[model samples]
Target: MIVSRTALLETLSAVQDTVSQLIGDLNESEIKDIEDYLGRICRHLRCSRNALVSINKLPSEILGYIFQFIHADFASPSRSWIEVSYVCRHWRRVALSMPSLWSVVDLRQKGFDVHKLEAFVQRSKAAPLTVFYQNPPSDHLVLRALQDVVARNMYRVRHMHVKADVCPPFSDVILSEPAPSLCSLSLWHKGPAFPLLHANSARALFDGRAPLLRKMTISACALWYVYRITSLTHLALYNSEAHWFGDSFVDMLDGCQQLEMLFIVSPHLRLATEVEQQHSNRIVTLPRLHLFYIVRVVCKCYPLPWLRHLLAHLEIPEYCDFRVEFWMTDREVVPEGSILSIFPPPAQFHPLEQVATVKLLTTSTSKSCIAVHSKTLFIVAHGDAFPLGLPNDFLCPIARIVIVNNTETTSFLLWRTLLSTTTHLKTLDVFEKYLDTVEFIQLLCPDLGAEGVSPVRCPGLQTVNWACLSYPDVDLLFGLMAMANDRAHCGSPMRAISIWPSVNGEDKRTVEFDSLGAPMGYFTRESTDEDCPCLHVVEGLIAAATPKRPDEDGW
Candidate 1:
């Protein structure tokens, strides 16, 4: 007879109560027998409950596909696929039966479990593997065990990334057999700058063959071996040596005509000889190239000829986006009257000639950053080295729109130098937080008075939008009214002017119009609802909520 669920629970509870009373009266041996019998009953009940769950009815193939999304790696062994298998016997069977679910083995992680690695290889069957090895301990027995397992499956290995402070013994030795399935490889050496394997040894390291190799990333030492692989479509060279460029570099570029993306970073340079000059003079066109990026991390010294030489040689399509960036640190402050070096003349560099819009931004960190439109040329500089004056005549026709955000008085003064450079500037948007209101008004709309000598800096500027910190005082309000009156007399009235003051709370806007019924924008004040009765503490709260960086301002 089939029993109801409630009756089953009632009977089980009665049996449990009786067992509990008998356990107290029984001898140790008799209690052990009862415990074993009870264990079997609980296990059977759990299994029966699991069978009733709807998910247990899924086909093995569907269950296996779902298990692939479990995201297991050696980094966090507790969260690996082994955890999923522990839920039920049927789930464990399904997970174990799927080979693709155990393909990527990241052995670089701490807590190296040889059993799990062995299990992965066993369950993977014959699928190709993607492996990452970095910072593994030097346990000889453990290393030997891992090597043996990899040796048995080396032929099926495909994508591998090896980053280690010190080279592991098996790194080169594992490639003794040709990996027919291998396609992508990235090797990073974070240790001292020592020569990687010799050119011949390096070529032989990969058995002088990887017919299907399409992408490779190598640093200083092994770059000479790039020519051995002509089938490459994407290449990245990090921390490249001086000797790698000119002929060898260009030859590598020539060989990889199929390359679509190229990235070079933090490359040191040496003065180019006449032979290198001849190689650079020869134009190398990459028809398939779409994106090229070169970045130098910190610039203590100006102008790297090799980079200039590399840019001069490549003839990429107009549709392609080419970008170059040089970072200037606080340690390298610009010498007096030499700030123009930061903004090099367009003719000097072929890429900067096409810049359309320029943004000069000052952050609370006492640093400034410039971003130029051409889909390229982003300069990040720390400390105060403003790009002032017209660096060259090339920028004269290019820069039409300018935006400046200055948070300190020092940066505000530095920005005036940049404004003087662009003669044809149409729109100027200024955001300043630390400047005197009367002085700011005098600079924008100078009080000609009886002298009538100085003129507005940007004569072509038709529209102006300015924002600054505001108080309850009338100084800024009277200063803006005087500014509007001056602009009307000059016959080039501002198309629109918006003065925004960052007060304590929500924004309140009040607009006005001129005698001719022309609409003039208004200043924004903090909402009255946020008015704190405790006036003494308002400053502290405002300071606490203010962001200290440009990015922290949320755009």
Candidate 2:
């Protein structure tokens, strides 16, 4: 007989009361049996209730797909999207049936479980794998076992990344097999500068069979030989012995004609270990090569031809976005020559020559690095060593410069040097927190030149926008008025002057002409304590609610 839900519950309640009355009279074993029976009933009741829930009615395929979205290799063992499986048996069954959800096995953690790895492999079935391995199990036997598993599943492995501090024993042995399905690979060795492999036959990587490999990275490691992979498009080498490889490196480039982006970054040079070997003068022309980036290269002794010699071998496309990061090799002496060495040869187009705009934002780090790119150049430096006179002739194309959120004075020479080089600069915007607007005005409007032949600084400048820590006091206003009049007299008349957010009017209030009426725009920003009595109180409450970085002002 079909019973109503309420009637069924009433019947169950009566049975529970009858069982309670018998519990006191029953023996210990009998009571245990009754408890087990009640537990089973409770499990059935939970399943019944869950069946009535709306979401549980979703098809198993949809539920499994949703599980895949939530599943991630965040941590191991417990914190998995698979946790949803524990909520119900149906979910567990559905999750087990979906193979792709368990494909990526993160064997990077120190506390990784081999049993869990085995389970994932079994559950993944025939799905393509993207294995991430770093700082894996230290035991030699365990490493071999893990390597065995990877080798067994090599046919389906699509991507693999392995980074180990002390080069693992299986690092090279695992690459001996033909990776038919491999598409991308990254191998990083953080150990001492030792040879990456030991082989008598000089076998190349992947047995020269990674047909589908499109991207590869070799950091602080070396291969026996440069194998030709026609499909490689992106290649990045960090701290590798590319200079020592010499002709072999060029041969590798020649093999991959379809290569597009190449990155050679942060090579800590070691001359004692390597011998100077002469390379062929033949320049390899990469027809499809577009972006070539070299970053953070240092040679304590300037005029090292190692890098320049290497670059001379490659003829990249003229319009390619080539970028180089140059660090000051010798701080005591002026590094003009050292800096010049890193810049693209005077024969070719300097990347910085075409930049129309430049932006400088102060960082929290003391150490500085300079990045010169095709469309823009980012020179991150300390206030003192900030590359003054950097915007020389090559930066003449810059029409606008924006300096924002400076916590300290960058350099006096920086302002003067910029003014002298900016031949076509029309817009200058400075959002500063360290210097007063009056100070900026003084720095900007310097003497005309020797014998007054040269024009005023920024001869073609027309518009100026400035924001500072302190509000526009009377002195700042007077300084601006004087600056405007001086520029007008010098034939570089001001077009428009703008000041945004006096203090903090984040929401753009009415932007219009100021009282003086010489403006493209002006906006009344916020005022601190003076403007609002509860401002400090509200700020304190907000500050107390969240975490702050060490470099923050309040922190």
Candidate 3:
């Protein structure tokens, strides 16, 4: 039974009168006893009233554990976890007492709340802090507040992310004292509103080398500023301006010897710089580098030699996965052949005994993406103004190619050029719009019309998996049959063909054909493995036939 309001008020009034009567006569020990009794009575009353609620009975430790699940990324800040404190006095105490919940302070909001910021910092006490602050494009009080807080808590910060329109001259606040606890730092600068500030120099983030620093992201800042921090293991740089000189970029790569992954998306390098010219001919080797990704946008003034010089000089390990994607709107389009040369031949540097898999994905009329995977190399590229067709001689001994065509605007001539290069192609997986094209049919059977004029493409072609929307024509069916028959006569037969047909309107149908197309299974909305299990069985057969490649052969 719940206590009535009148009873609760009377009980409080009586306790207050008793306390008032003893105030003058009671000694320190008597006063302490009364305070302890009141605390116990309040807790007991609260528990008894909430006894039937399951969550209310949870221990403080359990409540703290539940609060740990709430986390927010710095890009977007949400403090919904604070709602837990408003539920009841017990919850409020528990929420405020948990330091982990207040360890991450985000000050990216337009309106700075000093009370909230101070509360989080105070509750965190000695716990390590992860701070995220973004300075608005214009002047704001939040920027000053953030600067003060960061300066004061430099010793406590473990991870810091700052994005601002103008660079802050705060090397003293960050690097005056050694940051033993700081491990990760990300700083991004939006271009200054005043052009004069654009020429402002960037000071080194840390006065001395950050011994424990392992990861960093610097954007729109001087590229060479971070060369002093040699302990970095993961580094990402994004500068849309002409901030990178070839020498500075090379020096940075050489300096960060511990880096395992490096990502760079920037404007064209300043190749004409005297410093860059001095080191343009020198080669730099990275023994431990594993993954490198570069995306660049170029105009007529910035030629391919800058990128070519860098690629030609660097000596990476066989295990490194290197990828470069570029967009060029200049009238003088760099030949696809030159871009292909950026990636070395696997056979020379990192040879694989087993055949590799290459994927071609053309998403639009002007943009395309491709990925080449081998035992040692995994290269991928994407660009709006790059070549739409895959380079045939870029990588060797490809066993499989998967083409994903998303747009109907893809050129048939481009598809033909791409297919003509796969000499050892074994399995072809074509999706959607390209399945019913005459170009695809001709690729399979080069001897269809004129018997001896042209040789058949993909001589080692074993299987074809085509996902179709419209019904395949009789001509396409006959062309495939002829190719299979010709290969069989030559003592090498095409193994199988699998077709995935989508249901259109009320036309629910199953196809049954003879030696030409009958054996190929049809997949529908309700088809199970029992109905179309040949694809899996054939894949297993292929895998079983292929042997494991040796390490030394992985090029």
TM-score of each model, paired residue for residue:
0.63, 0.65, 0.61
Candidate 3 lDDT by residue in tens digits, 1-555: 899989999999998998888878999998899889989988888778876588878999998888777645344556667678887877889989988777888876645477768888899888888988776565456666666777777777889887775444443355445566889988776763221232223544454545778898877765353435577889887763443435656666776778888777764354335224434555567777787777664433323455545565566665676665555555236435434544434443343333376666655432222222234223222222344344344556778767656555533545555567777788887766544344556667745534443644577777887766754554455466567667766656676765554423232222222343233333222322445454443333233333345653322
On lDDT, the stronger of 2 and 3 is 2
RMSD of each: 11.6, 12.8, 11.9
Model 2 gets an lDDT of 0.63
Between candidates 1 and 3, which one is better according to TM-score?
Answer: 1
Q: Over the stretch 1-555, how does candidate 2's per-residue lDDT look in tens digits?
A: 899989989988998899878866889998889789989989998998888888789999788878877766333454566567678888788878988778887776555567877887999999988787776345555566578877798888888887765354476566777888988888787676544545433565678778898998878865524344456899988787545446666777877788999888787675523536654777777878888887776654434355656566777665676655556555554444333344435334334456677666554454455444555555554443445444222443778877664655544445555556667888888777664424445665544222433334677777778765544443344455456657667666776655544446341212122223233322122423344443332233233323346775544
Which is the winner by TM-score between candidate 1 and candidate 2?
2
List runs of model 1 lying over 4 Å from the truth: 1-49, 72-78, 137-155, 165-171, 174-184, 195-197, 201-247, 254-279, 284-296, 315-332, 335-349, 366-384, 387-396, 412-555
TM-score of 2: 0.65
lDDT of 3 at 385: 36
- Best TM-score among the predictions, by candidate number: 2
Q: Write the per-residue lDDT of candidate 1 for residues 1-555, one digit (tens) a residue.
A: 999989999998998898887766889998888789889988999999999999998888888878877755324444566678778999988877777767877776566577867877888888778777665455555556666765777678877776654234665555455666778877677665544453344454356566667888876544454334566788887886644566556766776778888887776555435224444456677878887766663444434445556656666654466655555555346533333343435554345666555555554453333334353334333324543444444464433443444444344344445555666665665555554523334456454211453534565555555555654234344444455556566654544444455533234222333543233322233322355332322333233323346554521
**Which regions in candidate 2 have their CA more than 4 angstroms from the true location?**
1-24, 73-78, 109-111, 165-169, 195-197, 200-202, 224-230, 271-275, 327-336, 348-555
